[model samples]
Target: MSELPLNPRSPLLPDRHPEPDFFVADIFDATPKGDQASMEHPLFTLATKPDMESQEYRHGDIFVNIGPSPIGRATVHDRDILIYCISQMMARINEGRKVSRTMRFNPHDLMVVTNRDVSGRGYLNFKQALKRLQGTQIETNIQMGGKEQWNVFSLIADATIVRETRDGRMQEVEITLSNWLFDAIEAKGRDLLTLHRDYFRLRKPLERRLYEIARKHCGHQKSFRIGLQRLQEKAGSQSSIYEFRRLISKIVSDNASHQHIPEYDFAFDGDFLDIYRREEGGALPSPAKRGLIVSDSARERAKKHAKGWDIYALEAEWRDWVTSKAIEVQNADAHFVTFAKQRGPYKR
Candidate 1:
């Protein structure tokens, strides 16, 4: 990664590209594939620069879907690409193009962007604009007579912050999909692959190099040799990193961890080591990363408890030790030993 300018609001991720297969021809259609298709009908929105950055909690599921390891893999098969693919959909709308596709209850395109500034005001404004044109031909018209017909609809400012639970309970905690993307983009520039590298600019040297690595991982993160193995386990998730920092930033404010350790590097799902090796041409090993690799014996010991624990579970315990102890928890290894040993021999 390049020398970051230390700007808190810096654009974390470079530009993204569109996905090859945007979506199922009929999102609502139930094929033999068996995935639950929504019958709510397809909806379209236009993505704008503002929507790129925002904090909304409706994103937990979206982030899980588009991140390295989606909660439901089928929903967002290629997350990084999905990032740009969404932008592409937006561009199509901006260009006054027509998007004719079958739909059910799925976002037909990545048109609904979360503005990078002001808590999703762009999307919010867009949505308001939408409700106004309900009766006129302007319903979904983004351009008056330009090209694309994308129309902005409604946006929720900090939309997810005040959501109601299934039990009809409301909470003040709000999160957004843009926040997740911002974290993912900022934490590590490793996955901004060349697939669409031309779209973004990285001013920091460290960040630039990191993107080089991210580009590599996207190709093989799913490969059997290293891809699936990653699912074996990893340090922790990026959100964990943010939670650690947010806890402290609210206290005595120090910018030490300003550059957080992105979830990709330590997290189990991202292929940090693989991309590093490939990026560095197998020389100049990343000692810190290599050190994290467990010996087969240690790994075997950990695996024995795999039923009840994994490396990540230990790290989570380490994190909870204290949002107050981000430094201590830094050594996830200490946690591995402490946690793995406590598991004792499995009940064979």
Candidate 2:
């Protein structure tokens, strides 16, 4: 068969020499706090297209319902702005400096933080990203105060391009973040997680999603394991089970070879997958423990109160759930009993 012409559309292929649509330097200045990243929201789509279809995702009591808007739908790539903004704000907070929702920054600075180029086309893409963030509406049960109330808001409240280059490249940009997002930053910095600088370099959406799960769960711990089935559910991926398994196995193998993925390493043993942080010296401090402990008496009470409930299984779920939330429970045993009642008769 004759060799097919190089695919102009594929960015990954070196032989594919697509004509440059824009001129921007690919190198980025990964400065201090520049490589810092944060995500206040849970895992969402990794789609690059502006999909208008409405979708709902739920994990436990947390729910995120994305609605269509006239401007555009938010793509997962649009999350770059949030990661940059939140990471900067967190840096300030860490330094005992106050922060606010409205931020003024150079457009190029954002590109550096997100590991993008500073080209004319890149500037245009950045504006489009801002539009999607401002236009996409989300209804979520993520609380603002101490109450559990539904919040309806966009990812960004407003954006202003303050200055532009003679060639129409955006220079200064001002952003007013949605209250829902700002509240997440102010309420507790710990609610946010630091992502690797290479996160922006991840080309596949599913790979990004898996990395988020690893960052959230594994963090500084020696290792953490999740069943393949549970991981798929958590990812909310649409791929078939066989395809997902193959995809993940390949990622693990690839990561082992290159060690390109930051922060954590991936591995799988049979049905269980493990994520462990790389043993780099000067590890950032882990989040404070919840101090939740399941006592033997609590186990006894769980067995007595909830007949046919597996105490050990319930205890594991309770511990895992609370640990993920990073919250302490005053009464671990009583809480376990209540949780058991809700889940009742645990499945193997």
Candidate 3:
């Protein structure tokens, strides 16, 4: 297998918090969940540097126009803030607790969970990310949480630095999410998909965007295929078809060698791209057994939930239970992990 090409400009960040107990806070336990709308569309820029260009995208009747601020359009990396907020809100909802559009959190906690640097520079970059997120204006007809409306709004309504350290770094920060985004989070399972924690570790901007596409579209299925051209559009890449193909080829080669991409594997063949769920133990069932493909990552997580029990056995039981109950598993991996956790340790 060919080795991953060196990325001099934006190398992948090391896992800063590898130990599970690094975060003792309950909020850190919330699974990362991304809004489906932005994932489905090219709402954020993939540029590593400031991008001042305004872009428009149209798919069928859906239209999205994004304009950058003086600093630049929000990049995919900046989207981390939104993901963190959404995850927190979702956890509150799951607990049957009321949630508000405005959220306040410690900057350090956000940086740690997102696998970002905790240095002074990291905090500064984080504040800049907030600015890009708040300044970038978007006008869209995309319906979020089942509400279809033509509205022009920024990704965030406003962001305030509630408190700052003596050195002037933000300490406590408050962000007011736009109604469009909050509504999507309010819709719960309809507009959000759980993301792999390692998502923050991906180095390249294109790599992150590709993973989102795979997570959103392939989702819980054994595999998904898309034409190369269609994928470029979905990724919101500004590269020419030939250039895009070259970039994708590099990513496929890198993934093939290191298996760095979480959950899904990528393959490029001629004019199409195939995304497969990373499998272990045995072959994935044909047609994914009612679209319930469990990834190896999920299985490992399940082990924590049902200690001393064979995960495969628990999986069989979970599948049987779902079938018996005629339950439609929307997020199969999450549902299965939850089932295992609820099953608890095996009893003699």
List per-prediction Cα lDDT, in the order shown. 0.27, 0.64, 0.83
Per-residue CA lDDT of candidate 1, range 130-175, in tens? 2322211112322222233333322111223244347433323222
- Candidates ranked by TM-score, best first? 3, 2, 1
Worst 10 residues of 2 by lDDT: 29-38
Candidate 2 error regions (>4 Å): 1-43, 69-72, 144-147, 281-348
**CA shift of 241, model 1, Å:** 27
lDDT of 2 by residue, 240-286 (tens): 77667766765664454345567777656436778888888843222
List ranges where model 3 is wrong by over 4 Å. Answer: 1-12, 20-24, 283-348
Number of colliding residue pairs in each model: 39, 0, 0
On the 0 to 100 scale, the lDDT of residue 246 in model 3 is 70
Give per-residue CA lDDT, model 3, range 234-327, as digits (tens). Answer: 8989998877877787677456435577888765754788998887656333224454556667889999979976565456557657766878
Task: Pick the TM-score winner.
Answer: 3
Best by lDDT: 3
Error of 1 at 304 (Å): 5.6
RMSD of each: 19.9, 15.8, 15.1
lDDT score, candidate 2, position 218: 78
